[model samples]
Target: MSDDRRLKVLSAIVTDYVRTREPVGSRALVERYRLGVSPATIRNDMATLEDEGYIHQPHTSAGRVPTEKGYRRFVDEVARIKPLSAPERAAINALLSGAVDLEQVVARTVRALAQLTGQLAVVEYPSLRRTTLRHLELVALGPTRLLMVIITDTGRVEQRTVGLSGRGPDGLVDPAVLERLRLRLNTALVGRRAVEVVPVLAALAEQAPADERAVLAAVTDELIAALRPDAEERIVVAGTANLARSLDFTAIGTLLDAVEEQVVLLRLFTSEDAAHRDDADDTGTTVRIGSEIHEDALAEASVVSAAYGPGDAVAHLGVIGPTRMDYPATMAAVRAVARYLSRFLTGTEGSTPG
Candidate 1:
């Protein structure tokens, strides 16, 4: 058989198996795909494929199934990623437009992607280490208590209340001192990564007047603490139940264990090495099929991840499903959602979620 014919036969087998969740035979491929080849010719191609390790016979009498290698080839060469329909695009906009806060946007995005692709979706929280400060506010709540709020470019807001050790003559945090410190903080922090803003804040506090130094120190400490990396990176996951629907009991248990383990999920989402090596156009999607995934638990699954944010600063979001998933539709949904999410985060598409 010609090499092109063999590849076509392989593609047909992969598509049929994905749709029916069953092994595929040469006769079935000819019948279902109109491959214009005799059963004898197709069987020869199947034999070649099996011999090359692209497919395997699960049983002596059963038809062939695509191996991990075959699935990888199908995704990279055969699958034509379909574009989202108008209604699907509309649905995503409707579901995400209502979010008024960063948390709600994340929650909505995760749910929407899960429902769109029928797979477990994971979205990483916009990292403070990657986001620039948007604004800062300080409010006096009492004679010695002041509230400090830090806002990031991604619409994340973190607030902390600091107590002033030394108060003004009027027994309140002096308004003049507070205003000067606020201006200084903004001057040093605005448009800078939250994690990198610490040293600037420390320098500002050190230069403040003696009477105001105590309050400045307290405020600076709170700001840095708020921006410090959490003990575990935050990720929002949805559609875990979909795994039960598609995977067997044993497979489901193992997959769930991997998902619930934050470290494993984090490594899956944050592909620092892949990110550095990715020289594809900015919009290209990342696909890891079966063994391409480093985690043993995910050996039976595929990951479709994309970075979403303005310019180069981004957070990862995507779905995990069995390797037999519909690659075209899943990839399109992942890419489209990432586009919407990037727009929403950068304030180019809709209002920030409340």
Candidate 2:
């Protein structure tokens, strides 16, 4: 019973300190919370908690604040993330709906998360290696020019226009020939991963008729260009102004610089915390508090992120903020955004509840 009560005391201290941004005193906790303990008992519980390294007194005769260890314990102990209300879910769905392209979806997501959570938000682009081709489209712009459209399973669409004038002396590509090549490319490449499509494309080119050779070569070159980068090579960030509103932060300069670097922020989303992906207890959210983030710039900040993508292709998105932020509420917002984003990419809207 004392253990449970002490945990309650610790939880109350964290809650109050996060709200007030000041040391939490036993008296303040007793008045603000329903811990159902006497003042002396609360004080004793606080003392024991401090001794356990879960909390600290910042100055002589000051109230207590949770240490990073304490925040970790509190986060681990949370039984339920605060759920998004119906309107919030609607808002997220509305924001993400009708995004015609992958870039639009990512842009809307960052805006939605930053607006919802009032924190810096980031969404990393899906890695090409993990994405599969859903379709290959060839549209004849002119007799000797065609627009090549590559659609990935993750809803990433890349388009490039190629000239076939060298092959078309009369500046005319036979419509029948273009259609045949499109069909052949789709048959050989669709549903295959980016890595798996190269050899198949090369094989198609090797056996191609003279007229189709230029188009196939163009296809091969463009496809390789599209998929050559690392996972999350492009990340979109929003809400730096949210960080500007914070008054107590000491590492703001380094953190802002890291945000600009973008590659450095990947540690919070993909690299260092890669193995900690949750079992999708709703949205596979991962929370990194303070030192857990492993970046000196973010040592005083926290990151709450989730793996978000369509089907087997996954990328990451999250909010970056001071450790004093609301974990449950922020987690819910991140989860909601990620879930909606995955739905948008996969085109399976109603299969999962938001």
Candidate 3:
């Protein structure tokens, strides 16, 4: 069989099934799409495709639906991401510009992606690994307790209240001493990335007065844990209701469980394939269908994701839907959103929040 002609028939089946949400027939394929071949030829091609495990018939009387193998071929060999329309670019610019914080930026991106692609949208929080400390504040909550607030350049704020001064709550901290230590920490740790802060924290702890070393050590330990490479990253997801609308979702309960777990979704975005060496369009976007996801809960779903950053992927944005999704359109929206977010983060397009 000619690979090109068979692939053309498979592509038409995928496109029609995605649009109509029904098994597609060879007659419909010939009438709607310009296969330029006779129905008998299309039928022969489809039979060959099915024999090769590319398409399947759920019922003996019904037409065929693209199987996972079929969708994989279409995605890998046939689909080209549609270019964003001028209006789409304009809308993205208007909606994403003027965000004031990282949370808002992520939320807007997720919701926009959900709306654009009509799928469940997930956007990973800007990883602290790539961000610098903009400021660090220490506030006394009690004589032996303090609240530590970490502010990153990306506008993420993490706060922790710790009373681990080692001497226990009975041994009160001097107000003046706490104030001095706060100033010293901010002076040394501010303007440094997570990787750069580790050594600086160790030095600060090492040089501290004997009485203060324990407190500084505790603080540094917490910060180090927060910056650990294995830290569980957070992701924001919207359009869960989109899944409810689909009768075709195979394991709605389990898929919802996976969404709540988020670890599975995070791995999906931060997988080995997501990181790219350069900003080429082909290498940056990932399309995972069915068992390709390797998650049983997502066995009947398709995910389109793209990493967005200055160059290497500091974070990822993705759309999740049933296998019968508009691959080209979803890929286009995911890639476009990723590009706009990359520009925003690098201070090239949207104003960076302070």
Candidate number with greatest lDDT: 1
lDDT tens readout by residue for model 2, 1-354: 249888888889888987898899988987899988799999999999999999999997899998888888888775358878888887787777777878898999999999989899998877666778889898888866788898878877777777664445666777777898999999998889877877898889889998888777876777777776543366889999999887657979988998998867766555723544432344577888888777888888988888877755368888999888888888889887877778877777543335
TM-score of each: 0.88, 0.86, 0.88
After TM-score superposition, what is the CA distance of residue 40 in candidate 1 from its true location, in Å? 1.5
Off by over 4 Å in 1: 140-146, 161-172, 228-232, 272-276, 279-282, 350-354
- In candidate 2, clashing pairs total 0
Model 2 ranges with Cα > 4 A deviation: 97-100, 138-147, 160-179, 229-232, 266-268, 276-283, 350-353
Better of 2 and 3 by TM-score: 3
Candidate 3 per-residue lDDT, tens place, 131-246, comes to 78878887767766778898876677888776665654566666666777888998998878888998898788779987677778777877887788887778999999998898
Better of 1 and 2 by lDDT: 1
Against the unseen true structure, what C-alpha lDDT does each candidate score?
A: 0.81, 0.80, 0.81
Write one digit per residue (lDDT tens) for candidate 1, span 6-60.
8898898888888998889877887898888789999999999999988999999
Better of 1 and 3 by lDDT: 1
